[model samples]
Target: MVEFGALPLFLCVMGLFSESLCFVTLEVEVGDNVTIWCRHELIVSGYIHWFKHTCGSAPLIIGCKQFFGSVPSQNCFFFNESERMVVSVQGENTSLTITAVNVSDTGLYYCSSTDLMRITFHETNYLRVKGSESRRQSESAGF
Candidate 1:
């Protein structure tokens, strides 16, 4: 697993090409868990990839799950069941779950699938993480 240390603020830019591209925006406070859902119509035959691409950083393959392939290999890559980042695929739906989200977790997540020699982009999500000002205030007030 790759770790991205403290980074600067991100500037998210998305270019629309076709109607098939799914774009979603989400907002969650720090320390909260967030789940991104990706739906695809293509029958998954090769590999399903979950990538996190920040503004200034290169795209990182945080999670992956392989389906029907000739070469026998691991089912998934990078994250396991207990990791903070987990990717689950069920039929035509796939989800990426991030637990205890923080400032650095903010970025544009992309879900894609590969079958044969073709790759299809399924969804793109822009996650915005808010600071825990309200949580701190509530703790100070002992609520």
Candidate 2:
């Protein structure tokens, strides 16, 4: 199914990390791993959350797997399942990863520090998923 491409709408929301820069970019196959990045200052500590909001369908909350340590009760899966999501912390850097990419994964993903002191999920990503099998078949058969 195709949906209208709409600009990401920001939910009225930071000094951020004084000198810290946060960025989350994902690259993966249709049914492989999807990684989210959040790199910045080392002297800062903040809770992070990853969310994917489709234009039409309900937004999905990445689960406890990605928590820095423990999952926040209020931030729990109050909306959708977050099991597929996992958190990876390297030193002071924070990032989220998702497995099994799907068409539904196509949408705007947002990342924010639970403290609300930092904001960076401002980018909207439009992912287009095509069947690899279909492509292979077409290639073998030739145009």
Candidate 3:
């Protein structure tokens, strides 16, 4: 007979090495354009979700359901008005593009995908925006 007590432990161990979302940290200057890519290999029906996480605050949903399909069926909805934010998805590749990125856009961004089987994969990328010397100095001076 199979030991049911050890099944949960076995699954937990497997989950640790599950496939992870693929992305990289990005550093760009103000007004620069950048794209973050998220990739998954699972062949299950799923939806992709993007979020921006700021310090000491809840994550803000930047986009969702980024996939290749009809516009209404696979559309990205931005919680805030951001003319710079654009998202595109094709098969296993989902990318978020930011045009003319500003200082306020610097933060941690996450890309998550969940399939019908309830298996989820997610990755976080840190975006750093460089500012002018004056602005940096002012920030350092507590301004």
Candidate 4:
């Protein structure tokens, strides 16, 4: 005999929460390159920036940073010098790539999109130094 109530109960026991959209990795050797990818949205057109808000206050510009010169500098953070970050408004991807990953580069990073009118969608991603390959392999095996 089959039980209908049991199936629903089984599913309830499993934790299902937020939906993941993009595939990104922070794999870089001590002297290698690292890229951070995130799903982008069309709502962000004119203004695009990458902020390393370790505590999620606000976002800031990346390269050629002018510290509240023309960009919105709502929060301050401790950033690394060697970190390479890039945002693509065309590809709907706020992916960042860093060369020569160092211990100082590890922190909580957020990819945010904005327009001159309002801020759009943003997703938080972490930068770690190791085991991304194993994690990817494990996810594949599970399916």
**Highest lDDT: which candidate?**
1
Which scores higher on TM-score, 1 or 3?
Answer: 1
Find the number of clashing residue pairs for candidate 2. Answer: 3
Ranking by lDDT: 1, 3, 2, 4
Position 12, candidate 1: lDDT: 27
lDDT agreement of model 4 with the native: 0.46
Runs with alpha carbons beyond 4 Å of true place in candidate 1? 1-22, 42-44, 69-74, 77-82, 132-143
Superposition error at 68 for model 3 (Å): 6.5
Per-residue lDDT of model 2, residues 14-116, tens digit only: 2232211322334445787766665433234344555666555566656422233333323344434466766655654556667777655655565544433
For each candidate, give its TM-score against the true structure. 0.68, 0.50, 0.66, 0.48
> How many residue pairs clash (N, CA or C atoms closer than 3 angstroms) in each of the candidate models, in the order given?
0, 3, 0, 2
Better lDDT candidate (1, 4): 1
What's the lDDT for all of these models? Answer: 0.69, 0.48, 0.65, 0.46
TM-score-based ranking: 1, 3, 2, 4
After superposition, the stretches of candidate 3 with alpha carbons farther than 4 Å from their true spots are 1-24, 66-73, 76-82, 133-143
lDDT of 3 by residue, 42-100 (tens): 35455677778766677787877644343332664544435678766776777789998
CA RMSD of each candidate after superposition: 9.2, 10.0, 8.0, 12.0
